[model samples]
Target: MGTAGLKALLHRVRYEVLPAKSTEDKVLAHVPRDVVVTVTASPVKGLEPTLDLTARLAAHGYRVVPHVPARLLRDDRHLKEVAGRLREAGVDDVFVPAGDADPPAGGFEGALPVLRRLSELGSPFARVGVTGYPESHPLIHDDVTIQAMWDKRAYATYIVSNLCFDPRVLGEWLARIRRRDVALPVHVGVAGPVQRTKLLAMATRIGVGESTRFLAKHPAWFARFAAPGGYAPERLLTRTQEALTAPSAGVAGLHVFTFNQIAETERWRRALLDRLGG
Candidate 1:
């Protein structure tokens, strides 16, 4: 498929942001008007700011999908309040993740619990997204992750994959998901063109080592990003593009991990699409 075909296939585009000093305004200013804008719930920033950011984006006429970390929600009441706030702001769609919290927050220990509660509430959202780790999760086992998705399928509308460097692994994972009958439309995650020094600095700041299991699975990527060539997301995207176009695969769109490098990412996206005549 060409660029136009690919563009036409995209239902939404997400831009993730931490609850930084000027993150909300910066993301709002840079994100395209036509696509959805998602605010990430980071361990450092917490949940309140993500909700506020999502509301702000919704006000700006973008469909906002906020990440609702399971541990951040204190209880069912808290979940209700969060859902209410999104509804009031005309925001729909959410990404539920178990989160990086050290301990469980009350009754909700993971995303499955939160998703179950959301289903019980009968919210107005047209979609609810769940995470899919194409690469190994830092802490969870592959079997456990697959089971989580199977359980979440009843509540989630789609799957947004975690960043993975290898296209073959991603494709194989997609096939596995299909075989398992967890056929939610997938949004393949890829990092946008990011500065090497900046990427490492941010990764270190975020304590990437905290997830040793994840590090163990992708030692090569860690080494590559740490080395001279650093991380270039295009090479991965190019490899995955054909897989994305495959007949049996239900790859929905690309979710660029801008890492706050929105301008560079957007430029790269446009240039590539133009080259493909999209």
Candidate 2:
């Protein structure tokens, strides 16, 4: 494939950063102001930390989007408060997920319900994102995930696929979405260059049970770590080049899971951009 398409997509790349300690410096010093920064929420720490980071990034003049896990929210009033705060923080975008919380924190049962509530309350965000599982979820059936995305189509501006190693699987899933005429543009979620250990740790933190199932299902993905240096997200992106550039695919851009390894991720991105003539 020509570098033109890859170059174009690369220019639109965004970063997803978790709220690890001193992540602010990691992002601000490494990631450029032109890139859209998406802050991720943690079930352990809840929503505030991610929102706080999003606000900090926005104040520094970057386009900021934060993930709002439905399970972390307290109530309708809490949702309204969060919306207001997000707007105040200059956040124009948000990504909602069902989350890995043990039990319901409040009324929101899932991302779909949260989307509905946001719409009902006059959504403050311009671009609201919903998750897509290109690979089957560990617990939820593939059919349910597809239906969830279809239902969320009414509210979501776009879909962000979770980190999946297999490009072929992602392509097929994207095609399936297109077949259903669920036209939400997809932002491919691929991990940036981070230690294999950190990636596994992240997986466990997100959901140990799901992580085990996920690793088991994609053994090839896990096996790669045994012999190599850290996983290179570029390889996955390159392998999915056709899917990414296909007009019918509606592959908007990339949503890189940086995992707070900002310096390395940014370096890799810039290097690729240089090679691709970005």
lDDT of each: 0.73, 0.81
RMSD of each: 3.0, 2.9
Question: Least accurate stretch of 10 residues (summed lDDT) in model 2?
Answer: 206-215
Number of the top-ranking candidate, with lDDT as the measure: 2
Candidate 1 runs further than 4 Å off: 2-12, 206-220
Question: In candidate 2, which residue pairs clash?
Answer: none
Q: For candidate 2, lDDT tens digit of each residue in 1-278? A: 45678878888888877776788988879888999988777666788788888888899999988889899899989999999999998788998888767686887879988999899888778999999998877688998889888999999999998878888998999999898888999998887777777666655564222223345466676666534663677787788888889889998888887767789888998899897773
Once model 1 is optimally superposed onto the true structure by TM-score, how far is the C-alpha of residue 185 displaced, in angstroms?
0.4
**How many residue pairs collide in each prediction?**
3, 0
TM-score of each: 0.89, 0.91
> Where in model 2 is the C-alpha error above 4 Å?
197-223
Q: What is the per-residue lDDT of model 1 for residues 172-236, given as tens digits with 9 covering 90 to 100?
A: 99988889999899888776777777666666665222122233356676676667776676566
